[model samples]
Target: MADVFDQIEWNVQKIFDGEPVCVHVGNAMECELKRHPSYPKFHTEAVRAGVQPASSSRLWESLIAMGRLSDLDGDCTWRLVILDCIIPSLRSVSARVSRDFRVDCEEIRSDMVATALEAWKDTATGVAPRNVRDRMVKAAFDAAFRQGKATSSERPMDDIEALSWQEPTAQDCKPRASSIIDVDDIRDADVAEQIRGERAGAMLQRWGCFDAVHSFHDEIRSGHRSGSAGQAVKTSRSRSLISNPNLYYYSSDLYPRHIGLSEAAGVMGIAESAAHRLIRTGQFPLPVARVGRSYKVSVRALMHFKDIPDAIIHVDDVENGALHARDAVP
Candidate 1:
């Protein structure tokens, strides 16, 4: 865990050092930090404040505000700085959630990081920007709780509000039904995308590629993604982008266009059998096709239906994006 934290820190610093623009921007930010009255007696002190910023700590808010602005403007150094602060808190979250959910702590950690970034973006858009430390942690922790076991029975959507964060107080370690995904009842693409968001966010967190994903999205929007989909999208320009849009097109750059039913099931956080049932009963919302042994689900259509990233991505992506129907995992 410590190594993971250190590696992320090292990577962010390396990126800062490696890029001339980042170097120039970082040097400027460094001077600003030094000039602040909250200028830490020790530099890591600012970060410590971020771990748990006091209500009165204008310094923490200033740092986070700056960091966020820089990140949104395309400089990732500050956001990484913000992420560094949450590592300790996320570790604790990972520990508790992992124990409660009876899953691997590392997976929980990845989810926490992914959730934090999702929270980060959410905060940037609609959430209030103040109260830098506590809110971020709470949001991430709350999201992780819901993002628990993918296959865990999800609570009714109407009950989502009742799934408030609670301190562990009993022997039961099971994740709250609210925290798990249940796309089965999803009636719209937005609902599906929200469920799908967790998986896509997790994938980026695993790849340590938030920066790359942002760049990839930017390239797509800017008409420079460099594939046939890029050209197609550039021409028609109708993709409701992951985490950022309400309209999208089926682009091969996002996927090879579609994926197997089982793989789609994994990404959808539902049982493979349930997905098959959806197809059999004609309830599978996304357009489906029989491509040989398996039913091929349209990744972008699912994305349009659900609102996720990586397809924002499917995990099969890491290993050649192949998932044939009944392809036995050896």
Candidate 2:
């Protein structure tokens, strides 16, 4: 049993190193099976070694079930089994980074793949248990999260806020002067028609009604001529132009900069009820801020538990020094 485990571990490490290994029946034929291509070769070798075909087939099936081998697209590749085990954890790590750091999903996934490749290169020979998936996840996540932290540090938090919804102001509505050609000066009929359209578009833009006009035009093109249909289109267009302030406030202000109880639980990958219990028991690592009936947590404070640098300061912390107050409290 010990010898078999050692051989399996050795073969797995070789697969990680980009070398292929054969799936064999038993210890007697193990020496002859290294890097053999197909099941036919294994069967022939086993039969020559006085082993029955039924025994060899059963052993192959058991190995496949145990994830010691993989038959992908008619080719037996052992490393793919390891990859299958780690893929779900990799996706979870990617989600966590996207949620916490607000990094692009594609960029985070690419970074994780690179991290996995690098880690595989450095892996030593050892008999890892079937549940080594979690370790792979943590390793990949740590690398990707560190890269995300560096990226977040380069971009100011205010930039993220600015990209989110901001209330439209007078400055936003201020129209710039645009020179329009007189339609009478154009000789070509088509050119004159184009100029008139451009002038109309400019006027609509200045009045902040271009989208409404566009929607109306689209409805006309789609043959929705009824008064009720026109009214519905207008209403939908107006709603689309106005950003939802609540969604903006929660996603931009509360999520990344401050960790509320629910947000903290999501970051820690735990249940909201469990997170609330931890906070009430004072077992949560960071200090929670009480803002009226709701609670907020500093992202900086959360970093302390992870031993990461406190690069971010919440807006509430800057204004009310809530972080300092929470720190000062027992």
Candidate 3:
């Protein structure tokens, strides 16, 4: 006796049982293509002949749409057909990503299938009707990748190597308007030693000390480097001050350059849990940075995303920030 999977898959194959094949579904589905009013053109064809609905790329969309209708009507033959249609693609994706995601190939395949099934429920009224099967496979791969990472025993790396220029051309060797580099530049001096002492360039960037070290490099290579570096820093600061001059009223050492998740929630007049929900769905303008167990929202990105000319952000008090306004988004 065949298992349920086999039985369902055999039923899907039966749809192609006519013409070059044989009649399996009989007159159950019209020989004339199914034109669903709620569905798009990608989901239908004017004439259905000499083509396998599941085998032909031009015809698969229509088949999937029809299958959805069948599923809703209490006959689940289309659900099986949809799974059979995407299995090969799922196999290929699971094979390619299993190693990177550190999950067994079969496990990855199972996860992908589960994701596909969940996504399947939305096919009838999904945002986009085109490229249904292809998107399903991609969605499955993404879901599997996330699940693999969450379950994997491995931890993320803390350090990353600095990027190096490859095969420098004459144009690359030419000095830029910013800073000059010498053979015996900061590479052989205190700057190099300090840089080496830091965990990694990536870590240094995260700690916000990258610029100070970079300024030292400029100072060493260009004897008057401090002038240029200071001017550049001042120019950047001036841009922000154009709208809000009191940005640095509180000492930089005392305050962080981000809005705490709780503070952001208070500003938005929503509960923290509600704020989290909005953040998860990307309904908020600011991109959230997860630091350990807490979240940090950058003030600059928040301001830019909301298109507000002036706002007090990254401050200790939410009442003094743009986040305090209920109209942050409109």
Clashing pairs in 2: none
lDDT of 3 by residue, 1-330 (tens): 453334545675575443221112223355453422211121133112112222344455555666666776887665665676556445544654454445676666667777787777655574443345544654675676576667755432211211111244653354332113221235443333223223233233433455564555445334443422222122123332123323212111112458788865543323455445445544454688999988987654544432222211212121122122222222
Q: How many clashes does each candidate structure show, in the order listed? A: 12, 0, 1
Q: Each candidate's lDDT (Cα)?
A: 0.50, 0.43, 0.44
Backbone clashes in model 2: 0
TM accuracy, model 2: 0.32
Clashing residue pairs in candidate 3 (N, C-alpha, C atoms within 3 angstroms): 17-22
10 residues in a row with least lDDT, candidate 3: 156-165
Q: Is candidate 1 or candidate 2 better by lDDT?
A: 1
Error of 2 at 106 (Å): 1.7
Which segments of model 3 are wrong by more than 4 Å? 1-58, 126-128, 156-330
Candidate order by lDDT, decreasing, is 1, 3, 2
Instruction: Tell me the tens digit of each residue's lDDT in model 1 across 96-187.
Output: 55544556666666666777777777667554454545556655665655656462343322111111123545432444232365655678
The most accurate candidate by TM-score is 1
Q: Of 2 and 3, which scores higher on TM-score?
A: 3
